[model samples]
Target: MKGVSTIQSFRVYKHGLKRLIQALGTEYVNLQNVYERLLVGIAPSHRIEAMIDDPFGELWREAQLLGRLRLRLWRSFKNFEDTVHDMREAVQEMMEKLGIGPDGEVEWIEHTSIRRQYKRVSFILQRSNYHDLLTRIREGVSSLQNMAIMNVNMESDRILRSQVRLNQLVNVTSNNIYHALRSTMTCRCQRLHEVGLRLTPPSRTIVPQDSDDDVIKELQFRLIISHMGPLATPSVRQWSEVLLQSARSQVREEPTTPLATKSSSSKKSVKFSVRSSVSSTNEFMQASAIIQPATATFSLGSAAMPVDSGMPQQIRDLCETMQTTEKRRSGDNCGHIQDHMSAKPSEYGVYFMDCLGDCENYVLVPLKDVLRDQSNGTLPPMLYSDKLRLAWVIACSVLQMQETPWIPSCPTHDDFYVVQKGGVPQYQNGFVLKHLPDRGGPGSTSTSTTSSARPTLLSLGIILIELILGQPLESLQPQDTPASQLSPSYEAANKFLGRVNMLGDLGISAPCNVVSVRYLKARTRRVS
Candidate 1:
């Protein structure tokens, strides 16, 4: 009976020590959470989900917990430092009391099983200040709002670059034919008139008899056709040289010149300005008509636009308002959903990647379907299988369809999904939404499902390459594919595609670097 009593006493003491260890570990983790929140503030609920799913969060949390435990254990050493002189004696005494003979023999022990019970109690203690943490989290949400503003500011340069590239392409194409035909008009029309007279029957007067009214009508018709003729004619290949030179000049200079511009034209206070210079060569193109080449032209009429501008202004305003409201509501919804899930640090990275990819895929897939439907049977005879280019094209098409200049070119779709689901994606549809997750909080979402601008023409050129290559954006990773060889499928596709080149059909030729055999060979090797 005495021996049994001693064993039970030893077991009780061991259990208490284990509980203390678990409590210290849990407290350390809880403190870290509070510290991170204070440092970064609350993230948007969606962003929180992404962070919770990432491995970094888990690793960081564990590292912090273990670190605190180690620190606490070291502190205990200070109290027991005086006893270190008898450390071997104390360990032997404790081991003997636990009913183990001091043979100095090592044996496996189920420490994990013993530790499990302490975990439950420790968890309860860790969560005891839930209400206070909740209040702090609520207060910290503003940090994310500030982060959203910062993201917008940082991306402004990129957005402006896109706008400038698009503007350059449009201006080059327009000016090429505009000046080329200005001088040609006088001679070209007279030549046509002379030919028309020669074609008249010999029985008629030598100059071809016609009433004054008929003569005036013929001249008017010819003038109208000449002015509209440039709009329908294919662009001259020479224009690309001008375009190349202009792009080169842009690269060499930091800014053409800074010009004063207005600020805060709308509720969001979006700004626009031109601070670039045009070269003397471009001036010549603007001045001369025959020197310019006519390229493909697209109508800027309502038929080409994606959205109907005919909607009642009141309804349009309501839709915009609804979109903004819906985004906030969906963000809240995501927060609630994630609040119930296990928030262990180890699980964060995996969750973040998967959730983000799923959300992105969802938005993109729908846009693809919409494009496919809109194209009807007009899709190319030989379709390219490049998903990356397809994604960019879809993005551009969506932008091109928008009626407003404020719409983001590549707005994050996760934001759209959240807002649309919330049924409040009516307002603020043009702002590009970017989410930066806090340690473990909900991330931001978009307020508008619609964007009203298109991607730059340079993006279109990249898309063309992607389509011929039959690859994804991920393949562009630096380590994944060497620059020397990227796509082989393009070689096979090029033969069939050459018979009816999209670029040629569009009346433009890509630069030699972009279309060269050496580049294609390199791309082929890269794909393989």
Candidate 2:
């Protein structure tokens, strides 16, 4: 009976192993298809060829390693499958040779042989390490997928910057009107150096078909300004010098025309020559004046501008003349101007400028204010789809700007703002504000240290939780806790997680409750 029981147990074990092998085969095929797709997607194309060249070789190397590991895993699985087949055949032979006793007991030798075979199979399974190999293959595939995503993001950023068309030669001192507007605003302002844009959308024109239908169309732009510190004077000077040198070179390359001389008509001819020379000189001067400002408005790079020591005086005089002209036009009127025509920079400082790109009728407002109004029941709750999209945008922003100076080490809700059109907040159009540290300000060092030490992921998790709960984490803290020893935010997260099931009662969907619980629990673990 014992021998029969052993044979039955071996048969069940063999069946289980066969199912596991089949499942692993299916997983391997699926993984291979995904891996092949990733390889093709990440291949260099004409649009992204420059972006993926030598600069991103690490990703290529990782892909190669993944392919090697996958091949090795396939080979190992095949060998394990063959070994399992051999074990099954041996078990069948041993069962066939079994001898039964009169009392319904099998031969001891056969039972011992089956026991030994089971032990051998167990040892071989442990030695195979098939589970570990599958785990590694899955991780490799995931890593490759993440690398592909990063590549796409980098290419998108490049395209976005190119489309924005930054005016590198913009005269900071002369463009003070933007600075004045920024100073008067209630929110903190910081320059977005990576994305400086000035866009003016083309206006629609209605051609007149009748005498009374004549109408003029003018292009309009919406200006968005942020305060900036002292301008990089050296960069500006270098740009001016290069422009002046280029103009001088062009003047030298032009050939001089010879004046006509005749004995009988010398007097008339000489007067005509003198008049023509004066007109030409005046035209050249006018052309230079017009070209300088127009060209400066479209120039794109500071690094490419060459320094010219010989033209320093000329460049200085030209800049000073332009500044004086701007001052005369602006006068002392620094008050708010309703029309773009009357707008002028204040005498205080320079400002960074941005403009709505193709967005006709929109204004920006603080996201914190929108949320507060929503909580007060003055505004409608955000749509679920918008919330999900906002979360995705925030996550992508963190990934892209983690190493950039524009993003703070620990970002909060206040760092984001929303777009409003016709008095309705567009939550999906939210953007993260840039950070600019005050120069030589008190506590700057300590603030930097503290922020650097804090985990940015934890802050992101808290922000996500707040979005899910539709309330600030601070508002959920227990009032009984003393302020002196309280970590209200962390405690609130823990409490929220503890009663996460209650979210369903408040009309929150089961999925949202699950997400909130996960975010809070992860946040709690990080805090501890």
Question: Where in model 1 is the C-alpha error above 4 Å?
Answer: 1-371, 374-488, 506-518, 521-528
What TM-score, computed on C-alpha atoms, does each candidate reach? Answer: 0.17, 0.32
Name the lDDT value of residue 121 in candidate 2.
44
lDDT per residue for candidate 2 within 310-335, as digits (tens), equals 32221111222222222222222111
Question: Which structure among the candidates has the greatest TM-score?
Answer: 2
Q: For residues 221-277, write the lDDT of model 1, one tens digit per residue.
A: 000010111223312100000000111111122221111122123211101111121
- Global CA lDDT computed for model 1: 0.26
What does the lDDT read for residue 508 in candidate 2? 33
